[model samples]
Target: MMGGRGEGVGCVGGVGGRRVGVRGLGGVFEDKCKEGENEPYRGALAPALALALAPALANTHHHNIIKLSLQGNVGHLVQQHAICHGNLDYKLEDGQGPVLMTTVAMPVFSTKNETRNRGILLGVVGTDVPVSELLKTIPKYKLGIHGYAFAITNNGYILTHPDLRPLYGDGKKRRKPNYSSVDLSEVEWEDKDDTLRNAMVNRKTGTFSMEVKKSVDKGKRVLVLHNDYYYTDIKGTPFSLGVALSRGHGKFFFRGNVTVEEGLHDLEHPDVALADEWTYCNTDEHPEHRYLSQIEAIKLYLSGHEPHLQCDKELIQEVLFDAVVTAPLEAYWTSLVLNKSENSDKGVEIAYLGTRTGLSRINLFVVPDELTNQDFLTAEDKEGVFNADHFPLWYKRAAEQVPGTFVYSLPFNTGSENKSVVLASTAIQLLDERKSPIAAAVGIQMKLEFFQKKFWTASRQCAALDGKCSISCDDENINCYLIDNNGFVLVAEDYTLTGKFFGEAEGAVMSKLLQMGSFKRVTLYDYQALCWVFSESSDSGHTLLDPYFAFFSAVKWILTELVIFLVEFNLYSWWYSDLTAKGYNKGKRRKRMRKEDG
Candidate 1:
């Protein structure tokens, strides 16, 4: 029943509601705050407005947009409702007339993965605000104010204009008639009527002149003017706003009421040949935020799609911080290769690690600049950047010393500024049947100071040589090799075998000098290295070996040889029969039995 309500918009009415405060031109400087998760207040506010205006209302929303993604359709709906609701309460008749309201609706994809063919409707009803306030409400993009602004609908209806009335009002009997949502592109502005089309094409910020409908003089036909406008496509929601200010006053003045059909209509020079320089602008002089494109990127990213547009480095950083640190772990991360500048050579490498709880983690990956390549690094260049002495052993070491994290340390090297650094954090695994790692960790290039300060590193203290003993391992003798549980060598005497099981190491025989203590042999368990206890230690190359394991292996070898000997000698059946023969357990010898004997 909200259809064609603009037709009866002539009468004036007063409705007692909260007086809305216009932020004015200054509001254009304020940054937009992040909206609440997925929910648009206007979806509910519109109905409340309808109840106050038309008490017999059945619905506040003609269609629901909750099915749309939390980023796009939902966000735009919230923005429109906010802009309308915060303006004023408008009515048609004084004190007791039907309340005037502006309804906004757009089709948005249900979720990130769904296509546009399945877009859901997001709609909101708001009290109609005066045109004056609407014209002054420009978005703040960290750029200065635009020269002027205008509002339009999806079908190209002129919602609000600054210095003009209805494009073609019936008469002065109506100051402004409610066209509800009229197609202003059908009318003329500047020299022609192509403003809306051009605006849509310049989805971001561009300079274009449209045929001005409803000029201030109401009689100017060819009054063409140039302006710079910022376009905002309300993210996820289906709406756009064009805000701009005039670039120049004019080259000449024409009669305010004269319509220029073809030839010049200026009274001073009716047949004057005009040049395009007076109103030509190829590009924006001070390009800034293009709202429409930004919203598209937002919607695309939220709906599980990669945004095609080049992400702003600052914006990209902010988004990553929010997703990896601030947002709940349920909001998984997406990767981005951010370019610091369009002309810059190197790009930032980014990755994400998700978790069950949204607890923020610090750097989990630290690639020492000197050690991140095919070339070898000296001890000083490598430092604790890796665990081992050789480059390959570093790879064998885990990125983190512990199961869930890395040893975080901040290097004092001033030269780290030119180096590429990445911070990685643990992430939760995905629930797919593959049971593969859904997410391992989140990482970002070490550019932003915010990333650099949260850096993590691990360090260790050097132990004295008193408890250490020399042992020959794998023909490469080592003073002391780190060993693990079950008498397996870890940091083998031979550096090449660090990652392989210590039991597989060659020449790992115990040394006689190390046979002094009950637990002189050292090993590691749960990642901690320690000296293990032995029954006794002796000189002459005596090693502390677990006797039970030796016994178990010997038994296994004997059983294997016995089976082979019986099979090779063709006595397998005789051996089996003898072993299972009834007389064996009964303590009595049995005569050969025939198949017929039951």
Candidate 2:
């Protein structure tokens, strides 16, 4: 008969074939003999029997060498096993000499029975892996010599790192170290703030930057290098993976590492250098493929920079010839403005033009020296330069216009002067080159108040012509407004209504004005009756009408009338029903009295 094993450890020894049957009760076994021959086999328990008793003896609190080891109740060999909550443990020994391995344990259970839905707690079954074998599975960097990957456990322990030894011990004795005892920061020296270790322990995924000192020029010099790290947890496990890269050698290295080629590059070529600086807003910074910010681009433009029109030799020559021809036109424009507006104080504040030489644009800005010295512009704008690309709306409108024909922009406020101005644009088409169709344009920024004054003077002239058509600039009875073709108010007595759509100002009269296309005068009798409300501001003679308020007022009136009608209808129905019931009751009473008298 085989004996009991020691400490639930398996015994590995060849045994002769024999049919053995034994009865056991309270940790004692009895074997029956045949014909007065009785002896107990006290060597070691069979491997199968030892495995069967493992689950029962796993949690027992007893020191029975008979139940532990079967060699005459004397326990010799002991097995060392670790048990911790939510932790993967390594074993020192498992009955078969020192194995030095880790295990993944799964709870083994008996099949379900009639009394219980789930099986009984039999024991734990575990799969063992040698530490040496597990070392081979640890990952390594596949690309870039400077970058490396590492792994750590949930308890801030180092599972794998570049500097950490994967397999521990000398060749004679294979030993596994307690990996959970080693902290990750012990190997990662660059983790000065301990951020990486904390993030890994907390199971967080993010990136951080750190600095490391490294030997340079074969240990002749040492330099501090910036490093970036990205870390995340390994799913289905308690470990995390961390990847690190040297900051200067990773992605976006081209931002500073690349050198300019020594050739006629667009930004480097003599003809295109000025143009490139002027049109830098359109050019993307290499590697990133993004243009400079508007604030930065505008600053570069206003510093007297000019574009070379993409180094087009023909286009450059044409623009140069045009500039020569238009040089005197600037003086002529200035003279005409001074000659015409000498009697009146108001005139053009600034006159600038953007010429489309090729695909790019160049601004030929002309602001009088006296006006430029004023605090009309913001501090930054006054300090920096201007680019035609910065004001695309003003430039593109003129560039796309028909040649020599003028188009006007809605009046907009300009500068610290608090004066409103309108932009008048006219395109200048090329005459000599039919193949290269270039459309240059000029813009004259005139004060909006100047136009208001002109209209006011015309009204006075009309009053002088006819007695019935008398009107004043501040007349409350008359409201004057000039609208664009799209019915957006451009000029109004109230400057606040300048940029508003016509429909928003007068919804009731909007259809009438839209239908009367180019008619000079069309009067509506009792015009105030069409509108519900007007602004109460007394400074402006003709206040802006609020159509939204009128629409809501009309809706409120309709709802009030509907509620009154419903209430009156309900009251009339009740009154009619009560009167009919009273008449029927009076008739019944008269018939009862006649029956009683009869």
Candidate 3:
């Protein structure tokens, strides 16, 4: 029996009715009895028993008695025995020897919708070309069907070429056959109160609905529902306005034939004005058929003073290029007036040019001359300066180059630098090269190291405090995992956290977890965490446990050390440490002197 103090007894053979009990062997064991008794045994059963069980006991106790001298010598034999028969638990533990726990409640798991809600915007650029022409160009450019494009406008009206026009023809060719209009009795319904059932019951018979549906289907893109009256209803009657609306229901509603002079009057009281007299009307109902005149469309196109030409390949390119050069100013001005009217003190001015996949934005920042020259590039092209202490004036100058443009400004405190520009430019060289605006914007705000550290630390803290640390990989293409305070993973087997966008996805996940109100702090594991976790696993070949646990523990230790180093160096603070400390010390001395004088 294996017990405390390693003491046990085994039976020895008796000689001729007399029993002999042996104590310590010291390399000698003998059974002695009377001379007349049977021949005394040469070897004692106790010694044999000890010899047989010693090897097994040594193998079992080798792990616990690693520091023992004899045990060290039996390392190879013990290891061999363990490999052949022993099962071990090799889970890693913290320095304090506590079992590492992970919580699924960490702030890093979220749905796509929730991620978008946290200031993620998806933008698409559109063109006026017919679906057929667009489709032809799509493959040539190697562009996604759901992407950006320069609008083709002739005299401010979207140009439609003959090739493109073929895509938009008579209602019969454009619309799908409405089998939805079949009798309700012939159709199957799983639920009586289903919205689809209701839609079938109220089947719309208007040609406009068919035309709109056909356009949408041809576009082959998901249409986000906009509640704006211009895009939805005309006097409460549904009418499709083919334009993308901004987040706040704002859109560019072009009136084809009406002049600016006539537009102002129509906008004031649109109900009384004839449709031909107005450029665009904000109404909840579709205009009457007789009111849709060709002249109105023509005037609206001409109002912007844009050149008109018969739609052709050359003409299309010319119009598109012109729109690209001029659209930025138009977009900027529209944003400004809307923001002012809304009484928003903090507004962002944006000038957008190009299409969805090749878009660029010019952000204007207004700053004083002194700070501006140091921080941002000047339009004057000052040499030898690589950095700016404040936003330069060049962005405002860029804004001024176009008409009706304005800058977005927020209220500022006295003596503070008022504005900063963030110019987000995407490589328009090709469709595939379009950078994600969301990613670019976030990239500017914080360093990748800072983000990674914050995420990993937060995750570890959450796991330590909570029993379960929940982690999910949004980008399945990449391998990502959350490490516990001891660096073990809570994820299932066959999953790994690796790849380029893993950190960003982890950040997004963390944001969602925060919203769900599960865990307060969440951190994303980075390469540093990976290194720590992996190195420890490689070192410990004796312990038998999940390799993930060893890694998790190492990551936790690494993060903990990083946090300590940052705190010790005062690196977490934004201020220049040496200068701030010096200034603070001076102030303290002055205060002490004044107190002594008093």
Candidate 4:
């Protein structure tokens, strides 16, 4: 949460002394932007790339010049020059003409001394022979290459590179190697124990034991293979097989045991009970084991499917009847009027009920004629104030329409000094409602000047008898009596009153006056009541009556009393009945208590 220490009518300082202006009522949803404002431009990729890459290669020589500068260099110097040129000539043609090219060929080389003579002699001796004869010379000479090719041909096809085959042979001449005799059986065989007794034991078990063991091993191997295969299939790659196998064993042992035990337990005790006997069966091995006797009672009530208990039917019916009888009469009138006047022109239609203390009491202000069809309102027309001087007339009209509720407009203060006095007086009046007459008088005076200028400030200050006082904006310069909720006056000024009223008061009486300064928004009717009760009281001089009287008076004056009345009389019955219908009597009781406390 954020905290602050000053009170004013306009902007206030927030965290880090940032100013946040007070937003007026009804400004929460207003838009701040004007229509047709152009959005700012965002940069494109071409401009961004040009900006990033243009500077680095701004001044460099061509590759041809760099190459020519180091054409005949040697050692690291030549290598460095070649690298610095950084050029490749892949095109067949030069700058002006086709480039020359050359080719060099060498006879096939072999590492063995015996095979070296064959390659050289065969190629030299057959230089004059036709290409076909030259190719056939190696096989006719019973060359080792020819023998190798024959061996591969007689056995199976030789799986060597295609380019090396001319020195070997075509498929018809050479025998192929028998890769089937490569001894894969050694890789496949299983070892046996060396002890004779172990061998005899193995024989007695027969090929049956070996076969069973192999089958069991094969089964385990198949399981592992499937685990690996499916594991990689899901994950899209292979992981550690050992870790997977270990995890699989753990799951099997623990989960399988649990499953078996649960199955057996379920079979042995098929109709076990639950802990909450009211909601479920209670058949567990404990002292409370029994058939639920309340089941029939619950079913009987639930059968109707009405959200009320059998015992609460009367209360529910009574509530429905009360709602029908006590529904507000104004709501019905408003609805009927709205329906009939759907097409009526809108205008200020002030309704008044009666006159009291020379004031025409208002009931409602009807929609105005010109504003009904419009969507926008200027600052002067914002609060539907058509004429401030005739506000009492509007109140009188509204009063005529609604009988019980009082309606009136707050007086508009003007003329600098007088305005401050009026506002200070209003603030003092509000504080005075809490039964502190002297504080109210002082509070009004403290803020007289500022209020005159249409600026309001509230502050805490110390009072006599160790109490606190608050100086609110008001007309007079009174400062001694006003106090806030914390019993401190906000104005820092000398509080010695020299008036005849101050001289008549005793110390305790003055303390009571100081205590009264902490009130907020006291009404005339309540002040009259407090005066009737405390004006002649002695001893503590009405100080004891201040806090309690203020609290009760606030409850009566504010709409909060009506809200509490509605909750207690209407909402409580409805909620309790609802809970009772759902077979939750205890819940209903608790809900009633909670509603009362709240």
lDDT, residue 145, model 3 = 19
lDDT of 3 by residue, 1-598 (tens): 1211112211101213232221111321223222131122233222222223223322322223333323234322222111111111112335422111110000111225556346332321111211222222211111111111111110111111111221112222232122111122111111234332233222211111110101111111112222111111111101111111112211111112333445333222211111111112212124442353433433433354423311123222322333334334545545664666542432223323322111223333222332322332223232111111111222222211222222221111111222322322221212122221111110011112233444456645655677655653433565555422111222211223311122233667645655676333322111101011234355655544877878998899999999999886785454564454333588889999999999
TM-score for every candidate vs. truth?
0.22, 0.30, 0.17, 0.12
lDDT of 4 by residue, 1-598 (tens): 0111111110000112211121122221111111121122233221222222111111111122223333422222221211111110112334422211111111222335675445332210001111121121111111110011100111111111111112112223322132211111111112233221222111111110111011011011110011100000001000000001111111111001223233223222212111121121122223333332323323333346523333222222222222232223235435644764642432222222211111111212244442221311122222221111111222212222223322222122222222211111121111212221110011011122332123223232234535755543342664334322212222223222211122132446545645675222211110001111236545764754699887877877777778879879897788777553345579889999999999
Candidate 1 residue 181 C-alpha distance from true site, Å: 3.8
For candidate 3, what is the lDDT? 0.26
CA lDDT, every model vs. true structure: 0.30, 0.41, 0.26, 0.22
RMSD of each: 33.1, 34.3, 41.6, 52.6
- Winning candidate number (lDDT): 2
Expressed as tens digits, the lDDT of each residue in 166-266 for candidate 2 is 23323223433434345676555557689889886765656777875432111112334576776654432344566665564333110011112211122
Runs in model 1 with CA error above 4 Å? 1-90, 93-100, 105-136, 139-146, 167-178, 186-188, 191-198, 201-204, 209-230, 249-598
Q: Model 1 over residues 43-144: C-alpha lDDT tens digits?
A: 222122211222111122222223222435454333332322222123456642333234333333233345434445444433333333222122111111
